[model samples]
Target: MRTPHVERGATPVNVAGTGGHARRSTVTTHERIDVLLSLPGRSPEVTIDDTDVSERKHPHDEEKGAAKLQQEQSFEESSEETTYVEFEEGDPSNPANFSYARKWAITLAVSFFSLIAASSSAAYALGFPSMTRDLNATQFEATLGLSMWALALALVPLWSTSFSEEFGRQPVYIVSGVGSVLMHLMVALAQNIQTVIIGRFLGGAFGSTAAAMVGGTIADIWAPSERGLPMSVFAIMIMAGPGLGCVASGWIEQNPHLHWRWIQWIHVIFYGIFLVTFPLVMRETRPGVLLKRTAKKLRKKTGNMHYRARVEDQIPSLATLMYISCTRAIYLLLTEPVVAAFSVWAGFAWGILFVLVESIGPAFRSVHNFSTGEVGSVFASMIAGCIVGEFIQIYQEKLYAKYYPTKGPEARLFSACLAAVLFPAGMFIYAWCTFPSVPWIGMAMGIFVIMTSLFNIYVAVFTYLADCYGVFASSALAGQSLSRNLMGAIFPLFSEQMFSKLTYHWGNTLFACIATLMIPIPFALYWKGPAIRARSKFASQVIHK
Candidate 1:
C-alpha cells in the first residue's frame, strides 16, 4: 500500500497502519513530526518518522510544504472567525494617518466652527446699548445676556460631550449647527428682552458643541508629538474670535441703519454658510464610532452576529453614559491636583480676558474719550499679541521636542513659566499706564502683553492635560472649560462695578496681585509634576505606560 502522504505542519490525516487506533504525524523542516494519536487525554508528542517516509522528498520540499500548510491554516481560521476591522498603523482610513492636507482641512473647518461659537458670546457685548435702548432694559439686565450665554456655554458641554462620545461627532455638529442657526434667527426677530436673552442662551448652548468637541477631534487626528502647530492655530482661532467679533460688532452697532438686530442677523448669515458647508466637508473622525459602524455593516452583509467592534462591548446606555460624563469633570476637578491647579490658573486667566472685553469700552472712554468703535479697536492689540504668542509657541514646540524624553509632559510648560511672570507684569503696566499723559500705545502694549501671556497659558494647560491624561483628556479639559466659562460668566457681571468703585488703576492692580500669587504654579508643576503623578493611581497608570 502507498504510504499516506502527510503535509508538513498541518493537522495531518490519519493513517490506517497504526493498529485500530489512528495516528497522524505532521512533519517539520528538522524532520520532526508532531503526532496526535486517538488515545484519550494524551498530549501531542514530537518524534522523527523517518523510518516510514519515502527517500524521494528533498530538504527544500519540506520547507515549501510547511509554508503552504501555514498559509492554508491561516486562511481557514480567518474564514471561520469573525474579524473586526481596524486601522492598521498606516491606514488611510485612520484620521491620524490621513494626508497632511486633509487633516488641516478638517482642523480649519472645526476651528472655524469654534470661532463662530466663541465669537457669538462676546459679540453680544458690543450691542449692549442698542439692546438696552430697544427693549428698555437696564445695563445690568442687558449684561445678563452675556452672562446667560456664558453660563450655557459652560453647562451644555457637560451633556453635549456625552452625546458626541455616544453618537459620534458628526451628528452632534450637525444638530448643534442647525440649532445655532435657528436660535440666531430667534434672537434676530425677537421683540422683547426675555426672548433675546433666551435665544442667546440657547444659541450658546448649541454652539458650545463646536468648542467642546474640536479639541477631542484634534486629539483624534494628531499624535501628541505633532499636535503643537495645529493646536496653536486652533488656539489662535479660539482667542482671536472674541477680539475679532468685538471689532466687527462695534462697527455693526455703530452703524445707524444696521443697529443691534443686525448683529444676530449677521451671525445667522455666517452660521447659515457653515450649516451648508459643514455637512459636506466634515467626515466622522472618531475611531471607535467608525469601527462600530464598520462592524455593523460587516455583520449585516455576512449575517454574522459574532462580528463586533471592541467599543461595542464597552458602550453603556445613553442615560448612564450621560450621567457619568456630566459628573466626571466635577469629580476630576475635586480629586486631581494637576487638573485642579491648571483649571484655577486657566479659569482666572480666562476671566481676566472676558473682564477686559467687558471693561475695555468704559476703561478707554473714561481715560481717552474714545468712541465705541474705537474702544473696540483696542482689542486689536490683544489679537496682535496672540499672533506673537503663536510664534513663541512654535519655539516652545521645538523645546518640547528636544526635552520631552527627559522632562516628560512637563516639557510643554517651558513657555508657561515665562507667561506666569508676564501676566502680572502686564497687569501692573496696564494699571499704572492708563493715565491721559501715558500714550495710548502704552496701554495697548500692556493689553498686548497680557494677551500674549494668556495665549501661552491656554496652550500649555490644554497640551499638558492632553499629554497626561491620554484617553481621559476630554474629561480633564471639560473640567478646565467649566471653570473658565463659569469664571468668565461671573467676572464680567462684577467687573463694571469693580472698575466703577476702584477705577482701572487699582482694580487692575488687584488683578495683578492675584496673578502674581499664582506665578509659582507652573514652576511647581515643572519640578514636582512627575512625583505627584507617580503617587496618583490614574496618573501613574498613564505615566508608566
Candidate 2:
C-alpha cells in the first residue's frame, strides 16, 4: 500500500490509479468525510469498470477495503507524527519561563486573592455575639454559620479544581469571584439566621476557588529551584488572611452603628475590587490549555484538520476528565501514605488554628477582661508571627537552595523540623500562661510562636507535596486542602466546649500533646522521604527537573 502525503492546507493534486485509469480528484483540506471515504485532500474521482463492479464478490467489499486502508494509513501516520503540547525547554511563552518581575506580579495577585478569601472565612467570628443577638439565635447556632462556610470551603474545592483543570484558570477565577461578591451581598442583606448560614456557605463555596487554584498557579509559573520564596509568601498570605480579617472585623463589630452586617459589606467592597482587577492581571497560565487554544486558532487559520495540540490527543473526554478529577484526590489520599500522613498532620494544625480563631476572643475576654476591639487586636500577634515566618523563610530558602541539588525535594523540610518542636512549645506556653496573673503579652508570645510554626509547617508540606507529586501536585494539594478544611470546619464547632470542659490550661495541653506526638512525622520525612519516594510508584514517576 502506498501512502499519500499532502502539504497542510493544500489541495490534493496527484492521484493514484484506483481502477487502472489515471484518475484525478481535487480534494480540499476543509472537507470533512468519514475516515474510510476521505483522504488528506479534497475530492478524488475514481474510474471503475462497470463490468468489474458487477464481477465483485460482494457489493460492500470495496467499502470495507477502503475503511481498512484508511485505518492502516492513519495508524502509520499517527505513530510517526504523534507529539504532545509542551514547552520547548527555553520557550519564552511558557509560564515557567516568564520574567521574574511578571511572575512575582502574578504570584502576589493570586496571593492577594487567596488572602481575602481566607479572611472571609473567619471574618464573621468577630461578629458572633452581635449576629446571635440580632438573629435571636444561640451562640452555638451562630457559630454554625462559620462552620458551614468552612464546610463549603472544603467541599466546593473538589469541583472547582475539576473545572479549573478542564477549563483554564481564568474562567474559574472570574466566575467564582463574581459569585463570591454576590454571596457577600446576600449575607449582608440577610434578615434571619437561615439566610445568613446559606449566604455564608455559598460565599465560602465560591470564594474557595482562589484558595484551591492559587497553589497550582504558583506551581505553574515558578520552577522548583526558585519556588521557595513565592511559596513562602503564598503560605504567609494563607495564614495571615484570617488573622487580618479578625482584626478588621473586630473593629467593625465593636462600632455601635456598624456591626455584624457591615462585616459582610466590608468584604463586598474589597472583593469587588479584586473581581474587577483579576481579569486584567491574570492570564491563562496552564500550558496544556494554552496549547489547546493555540491549536484551535492555528487549525482555523491554516485550514488543517490534523493540526492539533499534543494534549488534545491525550486529553480524556469531559466525563473521563471529571471522573479523574473527582476521584484522583481521594485515591491519592487513601493510597499514598506520605500524602495521608502530611494531610493529617497539616489538617490537625489547621484545625487547631481555626479553634484558636474561635477561642481566642473568649480566652482574651475571660482572662484579660478585654473588650471586642481589644480581643480582635490580639490577632495581630498571629499576623506578626506570620511576618516573622516570612523572614525565617528567607533563611529556609537559602538552605533549600544550598541543599536541594544534592538532597532532592526533601531539602525543603528544614523549617518543618524546627517548626515541629516550636509548635508544641508554643502550645505548652499558651496552655500554662492562660492565668489572669500572666500578662496578655505572655500569651501573645505563645500565639506568635504557634503561628510562626504553623506557617513553616504549612509551607513545608505544600512545597514537599508539590515536589513529590510534580504534575499531579494540584490533586495532591486538593486532597490535603480537603482534609485541612474539613478539620477547620469541625474543630471550631467543638472548640468552645473543649475549652470550657478542660479549661484553657488542660484544653491547650491536650492539643499540645497531640502536636508533640506528630513532631516525629516531619523528622521522619526529612530523613526517610527520599527512600520512601524512591519506593513509591507515583513519586518515582514524578520528574524532579
Candidate 3:
C-alpha cells in the first residue's frame, strides 16, 4: 500500500470500503478505518460535521472500527488537558506566528510603557527642590512623590500578575497603561504636592503592569533558548529608563519653558502613545488564554458540547481572580527561597542605584561646580556601562552554549558572578573618588562601572529565573520586583542623613561593602543550585510539569 502525504490544515478522515481498503484524510489524526458497505466505484466523499467528535459507525455493526479511533481521541484529549495548551499550528492569534513587524511593534510599545513609568519616578527626583519651594513642602515631603511611586511599583505587580493570568494580558496592558497616562495628567495638573503624590502613586500602580507582564509576553512568543537577545534588550530598557529620566528632567527643570509640572506632562504624552498603540499591535500571548480562545472557536465551529481543552478551561471568575491577584504574590515571596535570595540582592543593588541618583548630583555640583545639565550628563557614563554590559552578555551567551550545553540554569550565573564583583568595584571607585579635587571624569568612570555591573547582573538573573522556574517565572520576577522597588522607595528617605552623617565617602563605602559581601551568592548557587531546586516544592512541581 502506498503511504499518503498529509497536507497542512486538513483534518484526517478515514474512508473504509467493502474490501477493507481504507484511505485516510491527509489531516486526520485517525490511524485506520473498517468498512462493511458494498458501495461500488470510487470512494464516496463523507463530510463529518462538528457534532460528531467520536467515530461514526454503521447501525448494523456499531462495535466494529470504533475502539481504535476512540482510544486515539481519548489519548489526544488527555494530552491537551495536561499540557499548557498552546494554539494549533499556524494559528494567527499566537504571538509566535505574528509578523516580524508586528512582534517588534508590540515590543516597542511595551518598552515605552515601561519607560514612562520608570522615568516618572526618577524624573521627579530632579525637580524635588523646585517642588519643595512651589508646593510648600519640605525636602522630605517632596521626596514622597518618588517614594510613593516606588511603593506603588512594588505593590501593584502582585495584583496585576493575577489579573494577567485570568483576564488575559492584553486587557491588563491596555487598562493599566491608559490608567497610568491619566494619572500622569492628573499629576501635571495637581494643585498641591499631596495631589501630585497621590497621582504618582496611582500612576505607578498601573505602570507596574508593564514591568511584570512584558517578560511573560515575550516568553509566550520566544522559546527559552531563543529569548536571551530580546531579554537583553528589554533589560536595558528597564534599567535605562530611570537614568534617562534623570537626564531629561535635568534639562526640563533648567529650561525656562518648562518646570516640574512638565515632567508629568512628558510622562503623560509618552505613555499616552503606548496606550494607543498597544491594543492594535500587542497580541495575547498567555498560553492558557490563547488555548482557551482556540478551544472556544473550535467548539463553536464543531458544535461539540463535550469539548473542554483542559481542567482549567473555565474562565476564572472575577472574584477568584482578584483573590489570586492579592494573595499568591505574597505566598510566593514568603515561600520561595530562590525568590528571597535574589530579592535581597536585587533590593540592595536598587537601593544603591537610587541613592547614587539622589546624591550624585549634589556631589558633582559641590565638588566640580557643574551646572545641573552638566551633572545630568554624568548619567551618560551609565549608558556606556549598559552598552559594555550588553557586549559581555553576548559573549557569555556564546560561552554558555559552547562550554556548558547542558549545565542547567546555573550556567547563567557565570555572568552574574562577574556582575557581583563588578558592582562593588564600581562602588569602591566611586566611594573614594568624591573629593573636590578629583576630576569629574573619575566620577564618571566610577558610575560607568556601577551601571555596567548592574545591567549585567540584572540580565543574568532575569534569564536564570526564567530558565529555572519555567512557568513560575512571572511570579518569581514579581517577588523580586516587590523587594527591589521597596528598597528603591525607602533608601532615599534616609539618603540625605547618611550622606551628612558619614560623608559621601563613608556612606557609599557602606554600600560597597554590602555589595562585596554578596559576591559569593551566585558562585554558591552555581555549585548547589540543582539541590536547592530539588528541595523546593514549587520548583519541583514546575519542573515535573
Candidate 4:
C-alpha cells in the first residue's frame, strides 16, 4: 500500500474517536509552558471544582465519558458487586483543595528541581574546556555528552511518564532524583570521555522526570483556574535553568582546583538536597493513583473486595498512550500544516539556544579574552531577556484579553509577529556585535534580545496550537516538543564546526538569514489562520466542536 502524504489545512478528513469532545471551557493549562516546555508522558487529568468530573460539560468530557462507558461494559465483575470510587465533594484528600501556601510550596520545590535539570544540560557545555582536556575528547565528542543527554531527555519521557502515571509522581521523582544525582557523580569520577558521555545520557534520562513530571504535578494539584501562575513559574524555571547553570559552571571551570568535575559535583549537592526534601514535601499528586490507593485501603479495612477506583477501570496501558502520542504527533508534524509550521519555527528557535550554548564560551573567550568565569557570567543575560519577556507577556495578555473575543486565537499572533522580526534581528545584532573593539556588553544585549524574542515565540506557538486542536492539542504540542528537542540535540554537534569554519560572524548570520526566512510564517498564519484552520480536517474537528 502506498503511504498517503498529509497536507497543510488541506486534508479534509475527520479522524474520529475523540469526536464530540469539547475543550475544557476552563482548563487553561496550555496558557503557559507545555508545548514550549512540554509534558512528556501521560499528563495528569486535571480539575477539582467538580467532584463528579464525568458530569462536567466540555470537549474532553464527551471523550472521557465515551471511554468510560466502554470500560464499564467490559469491566470484570466479582460476585460481590464491585462499586467504582472517586473523590467526593469536600473530600480533603483531593490535592486541588489544598491551601494556597501548601500548593505554592509544592510548586516551588518541583519547579526548582526542574530548574536544576535544565541547568545541567547547558552547564555540561560550559565545562567542555576542562572535560575535553581531562577526558582526552574531541570537540564533537565532548559535544556528544550534551547531545546524548538531550537524546535521552527527548526519548525517556516515552516510558518514564508511564511510570509517573502508574506509581505516582512522588515515587518516580525520588527514584529519578537519586539516579540523576548519581549520574552527576559518575561524570565527576569519570576516567574517560566514554564514561562522561554515558553519565550525561543517564543524567538526562533520569533528569527527564523533572521537566515533564513537574507539568504533570502542576495539573495534578491545581484546579484549572489556579494553574496559570504556577505553570508560568514552571516555564521560567525550565528556560532559566540553562543560563543559571552556565553562570555557575563558567565560574567553576576557572578555578584551578575545581575545573569541570566540580560542575557535576555542585549539581550533585543540589540534587542531593532536592532528593532529601522532595519526598517530604511533595505528596503523591496523581489523583488517579491516589484514588486507587484509597480504594485499596478501603477494601482492606472495610473487608469489601469489590471496591475499585473509577480511574483504574479505564486506565490505558502506558504503551498505548505512548504509541498514539508519538505516532500521532509525527503524523501531525507531517500532515498538519499549522503544527508543521509552528513546530519548525519553535524547533529552530530551540536549536538556536543550543547553538548559543556551544558558541558563547568560544565567542567571548577568544574575542574579548574573557576568563572562563567571565564568559559564563555573560549567560546571565538570557535570564534578563526572559525577565523582559515576562513583562511583555503582561502587555500581550492585555492585548489578548481585549482583542481575543474578536480576534480569536489570532490575538496571540500579535507578539509572535513582532517576535518574528525581532528573532532574526536579534541574531543579526549578535552576529555583528562580536568585535573586540566593541564593548562586550553589545554581545550580552544581543543574547538578551534573542532570548526575549524566543520567549514570545515559545508562548505563541504552544498557545495557538492548543487553541486550534482542542482535544488533540497534546498531539500537536508533542510534535512541537519532539522537533524542538531533536533540533536542540542535533544543533550543537554541527554548531561548533560551523562557528569554527564560518567564523562566529557568518555562522550566526546564516542562522539569522534562516530565521529571516521563517519571519513570514507567523504573519501568514495571522492573516489567514482562521481560513487555513477552517480547511484543515483535524483542526476543523476542534473548530466545529
Candidate 5:
C-alpha cells in the first residue's frame, strides 16, 4: 500500500539518521517519522508518497521535453526498486510462526517479569513506614519513594521503547533486569533517605522496560487476531502486581526483624531470579531486529555488500529514533483523540490503583482497626479481581474472534464497555461501604470489583491501541503510558489528603463521579471508532490491513 502523504504541503527533507552520515539518505522526513512510529517488524512499503514526479526531471534540463520525460521515467523506476527481506513460509525464526506452546511460554515469561517489576511499585509502600523510621524521613519523603518509582516507570519507557524497537525486547529486558536488581540493592543498603529515593528512581527506570517493551513483545509473537489471551495475561500481571506485592510485603513490614531493608532485599532477590530466567525463555522476538540480524548473516556469508533489511535504510539512527519515539508519544497524546481519551481513562484507572496503595493503609486502619499486615493482605482482593478479569478476558477473546471482521477494533472494547459501568459501581461500593457498621469484607469486595474492572480497562487500552495503530501501536501505547503513569504517580501523593479531608465517603465519591463522567469514552469509541479511525492521521491506515 502507498504510504499516505504524511502531512500536506511540505518540501521533502532528508530523513533523520542514527548518526551523522544517515542524514544523506533519499528518504523524506515524513516517511521516516512513519517508520519511527511503527512497531519493529512492520516494514512499511518503502515507496515514496505519490507526490509531484516532475520536480526532479529537469535538474540539468540537458535536453528538451522528450529527454526530460525519459529522465523522469528513469528516476521513478529507480525509486520503486526497493527489495525487502522476509521470513520464508513457516520460518521457525519468525515468532509468529512459533508453536502455540512456545508462544505461551514466552508470553508467561514476559508477564511474570512484568509482574515482579510491577509488584515493586506497591511493595515499597507496605514498607514505607519502616523506611521512614529507619531513615528518619518525613511521611511526604516516604511518599516520594512511591512517586519516584512511578515517575521513572513513566519516563524511562519513553527511552526504552525506542531502544527496544532497535535492539529487540530480550536485550532491553536483560539490561533492565540487571539495572533493576542493582537499584534494589542500592536501596536495601542505603544509609539515608536521599540514597533510598535515588535508588527507587533508578529502580523504576530500569524496571520500566517491562511496562513498555512487553506490548511490543506480545505484538511480535501474536498477530492481532490472536493477541487477546496473551494481552490479558500481561494486563493481569500489571493489575495484580501491586496486590501481590503488598500481599507479601505487608507481612514483611509486620515482622519485627525483616522490615523495609528486607523488603528491598526481597525485591533484589526476585529481580535476580528474573534476570537469570528471562533471557533463557524469551527469544529475540522483534521481527525487524531478527530480520536485520538475518540480513547481516547473509551479507557475511555471501560477501554481498548490498544485502540489507528494509529498516536499515528506512529507520533513523538509534539516538534519533529515541528522540522521535519520545516526542511522537507526546505528539500523539496531544494530537490523537483516541489516544488521549484512552490515556485519560487508563491514567485515572492507574491513579486509582496507586491511591488504593496509599489510602488502604489509612482506611483499613482507621475504620477497621486492621494491622499493617492486615492492610497489606487487603491486596489479595486485587488478585482475586484479576483472576476474574482473566476469565472475562477469555470471554472477550471469544467475542473478538466472533465479531472482529464486522466490528473491527471495536470488538476489543466489550470488556471496556462492561468496565465503564463497573468502575463507578465499584467506587460506590467502596465509598458507601466506609461505615464501621459495614463489614470490612464489603470494602474488600469493592477492591475486588474495582480491580476486576481495572483489568479490563488496562487490557482494552493496550490491545485496542495496538490493534488500531499497527506498527505505530507502541508509540500510541507509550503516549498513553506517559499520561497513565504520571497521573498514577501524582494521584497517590494527594489521595491520602483527599480521602482524609473529604473523608473516605466524599473523597471516593469524588473519584466515582469522575469515573462516571469518563464512562462514555469506550462506548463512544466502540460505536464510532471505525469512522474515527478512518479520519485519524496515524491509526487510519492500520486496522483493515
Candidate 6:
C-alpha cells in the first residue's frame, strides 16, 4: 500500500488545549486520505465500515512513494525555510470575543454618550424665550439656534465618519466629545447670538459622532442573531436623551438666578466628565484594523520577509472609504424602495418631534401659564413613552425568539404597525384638547402617546434595515439619519408659520391625519417584504459570509 503524504498547511495538535481534540498546527496541509486516519484516539489500522481496504491495494507501492518523498525532501532542504503560525480561533483580542458583561458595559457607555449628544441638540429649545430676551433676538432668530444645531447634527457626521476611520474610533469619539465641551463653554459665555449659534453648530458637529457611530460600535461587539435587546436599548437611549435634556434645561431656565446659558455650561461640565473617562474604556473594535495588527505581529515574531497580508487587508485610506460610505448611502436612498418609504415616514416623525420641541414650550406656557421648568416637566411624558416603547420591544423580542426565529425581521415590524395607530391617536388627543379647560395632564398624555409611537416606528425601521442589509448596515443607517435629521431641521422653520395659519387644534389635527395615513405602511411591508426583497437588486443579491 502507498504511504499517505501529509498535505501542506496542516499542523500538529496540542490536544490538551482543546480538551482532547488534536489541534491542527498552521502552515501545513495533508492529503484527504492522510487526514481521515490522523484523527487521534481512533484505531489507526482500522478499515471504514469494516471493509478490507488493506487487501484491495498493491503491497509494492510503498517503495515508489518513499522515492518520491525523498526527492521532495531534497528540494525543500535547498529552499528557504519558512515558519508558520496558526491564528487563534475567535481571538480573545477580537472585540467579538469580549465577554458579554464587558460588551454590555461598552454598550451602556456609548448609550450615555448618545444621550448627551442628542439632548444637547434639543435642550436649548425650551429656553428659547430666555434666549430671545437676553440676546435681543426675534422669536424666529431664537428658533434658528435650535434648527441650526439639528442641521449640524444631520450634515456633519458624513465628515465625522471619515475622521473616525482615519484616526481610529476612540480618538474620534474622545476628540468629538471634547469639542462639544469647548463649544458648550462658548455658548455659555456668548455675548451675541452669532457666537452662541457658532457654538451650537460646533457643539452639534462634534456630538454628531455619538449619533453616527454608536450603532457601528454596537455592531462591532454583537452578532446579528444576538443584537436585538442591546440595540433596542441603545436606540431607546438615543431617542430619550434629547427629551431628558429638555426637561433639565426647562427647569434651569425657569430659575431666576439661572439662565439659558447655564444649560450649556451644565452640559459642558457633564460631557467633560465623559470625555475624560471615554479613553480608559473605549477599545479598538474594527476587524480590518485588528486583523492588520495581527498580521504585523506575526511578521515581527516569525522574522519572515515575505510575510504580508493583502493591501485590502488593512483599513483602507480615509478618503476612499468615506467616499464609498457616503456614495453608497446616497445610492441606497435613491434606489431602495423600503429605504425610501421608511426614510420618509421616519423623517416625518422626526420633523414632528422637533416641531414639538420648538412649539410645545410656547403652547404650555402661553396656554396653561406654566413656568419654563413646568413646561420642561411636560416632556417627561415623552420619556414615559420611551419606557413604554422599550417594554413593547422586549415583548416583541420574546415573540421573535419563540415563534419566528427563522423570520424574526418580519416579527420586528409589530412595533411599526403599533406606532402607526398610537401616533395618530396621540395627535388627535393633543389637537382637540388644546384649550386651557383641558387638564395639562391630558396634553402630557398626548405627548407620551406620540413619543411611544415614534419610538416604536423608529426602532422597528432601524432594526429592519440593519437586519435586511448585513454588511451594508452603516450605509443604510446613514441614509435614514440624513433624511430624518434634514426633516428635523426643516420642520421647525415652518412650525410657527403653520400654527399662525391654522389654529393649534387644526394644526395638530393635520399632524395626526398624516401619522394615521402611515399606519398601514409597516403592515403592508411585513406581509409583502419577502417578495420585495426577492426582487431587489441590492438586497437579495449581496450575501454575507
Q: What is the lDDT of residue 173 in candidate 3?
A: 86
| The 10-residue segment with the lowest total lDDT in model 2 | 15-24
Question: Mind sharing the TM-score for model 4?
Answer: 0.83
Tell me the number of clashing residue pairs for each predicted model: 0, 5, 5, 2, 4, 12
Q: lDDT of each structure? A: 0.79, 0.79, 0.73, 0.79, 0.81, 0.75
Model 3 agreement with the true structure over 1-545: per-residue lDDT tens digits:
11222234334222222111111223222211213211133333343243343445565344444555566666654333211223345656556766767767777777777767667767777876567778888877777777888899898777667776666888888888778878988888887988988987997788787677787777777766666766776777888877888888888887767878888888878777777767887777665665556545544755643232331333455566666556655677788777788788888888888887788878887878887778777877877888899999999898777756567777788888899899999999998888987778887898999999988878876777766787677667777888888998899889988889999888889989999999888888888888888888767665522
Candidate 5 lDDT over residue span 324-435, tens digit each:
8899899999999999999999999989988888788878889999999999889999999999999998899889889988998889899999999999999999999898
TM-score of each: 0.83, 0.83, 0.81, 0.83, 0.83, 0.82
For residues 76-140, write the lDDT of model 6, one tens digit per residue. 43232222222245556667777888788788888888888878888888778788899898888
RMSD of 5: 8.8
lDDT of 4 by residue, 1-545 (tens): 11112222221222122111111111222222233333344434333243565676897986887677656544422222334445544555677766778788899999999999999999989888988888788988999988888788777775567776578888888898889988999999999999999999999899988876787688778875566678778878888889999999998999989999999999999999998887677777777787678667766766755455544545656666667667877899889889999989999999999889988999998889999999999999999887788777768877977887887878878889988998999999899988898899988988999999998888788778877898887678777777888888999999987888999989999999999999999999989989988888889887531
Root-mean-square deviation (CA) per prediction: 11.7, 8.7, 9.9, 13.4, 8.8, 9.6
Off by over 4 Å in 2: 1-101, 543-545
Candidate 2, pairs of clashing residues: 26-43, 27-41, 27-42, 27-43, 28-42
TM-score of 1: 0.83
Q: What lDDT score is found at residue 346 in candidate 2?
A: 91
Question: How do the residues 10-65 of candidate 1 rate in per-residue lDDT, one tens digit apiece?
Answer: 33222222111111222212221223211122224333344323353787876666
For candidate 3, the TM-score is 0.81
Model 1 misplaced regions, further than 4 Å = 1-82, 88-91
Query: Deviation in angstroms for 64 in model 5?
Result: 34
How far out, in Å, is residue 484 in model 5?
0.5
How does candidate 6 score on lDDT?
Answer: 0.75
